[model samples]
Target: MSDPTALLQHTETRYLLCRASDIGEGEARGFGPLAGSRRKIIVLRRNGVLHAWRDACPHYSTGTPMAWKTDAYMNGDKTHLTCHSHHALFDMETGQCILGPCLGQQLTRVNIVVGDEGDVFVAGPTEEI
Candidate 1:
């Protein structure tokens, strides 16, 4: 499978992020720099659906990872995906920043396919940084 970071390029690589059941409702988890990229992939389950986004935040010219620590993607109440660096809150469903520095902007979305066996794969090309 390709790295999640490269999904923005629309490549054909597919990297398994996790099983859909690994993340429970209202919880988010981070996976990989994989074998090609330096950014982690965020997988979360909200409202019984799974969503994937790049770990990068859209606030700067070069995007930055949102979490301050391992798997720390959610806000204090676990309601929104948040950039711990500046406390920017993002809507889990749309990846849109609802508050803070990058208001109205969005985190990069990764195309994910969940197999019948429940494995989640990020579709993109695998390239070395």
Candidate 2:
């Protein structure tokens, strides 16, 4: 197969984020798959399920990213997600703001696809930012 990201144009808007192996268990990776404009999205595996979300925090104007460090999404206890900007806690499964200024808000979910070939991709059209 050709380089997946380079082949992404043929798939329209869908861009390959990474292979399943790249994320492993309880890991998250970022991808810029929106028309090559550096749109950052995060894909993570939690409890055997895969989730994709826009890498934007709900409390800020630009909606900052959740992780303070690279791929370090989970809190020190590994129980919830902690924001890099303000240390807000969010539910890993639901993306709900459990503690902090944005309580009751949620991180925007982005659709994802897992190809039979083991590659992961951003799926279909997403709500524009």
User: Which candidate has the highest lDDT of all?
Assistant: 1
Task: Write model 2 residue lDDT over 1-129, tens digit each, in one string.
Answer: 698877666576667888877876677777764663434788888888888888888897678767766777777887776677777888877889999888889988888889899888878765552
Clashing pairs in 1: 1-14, 1-15, 2-13, 2-14, 13-124
What C-alpha lDDT values do all the predictions have?
0.86, 0.77
Model 2 residue 38 lDDT score: 34
TM-score for candidate 2? 0.81
Error of 2 at 113 (Å): 0.6
Model 1, position 80: C-alpha lDDT score: 95
Poorly placed runs, candidate 2 (over 4 Å): 1-12, 36-39, 126-129
For each candidate, give its TM-score against the true structure: 0.84, 0.81
Can you give the lDDT of residue 83 in candidate 2?
76
**Total clashes for model 2:** 2
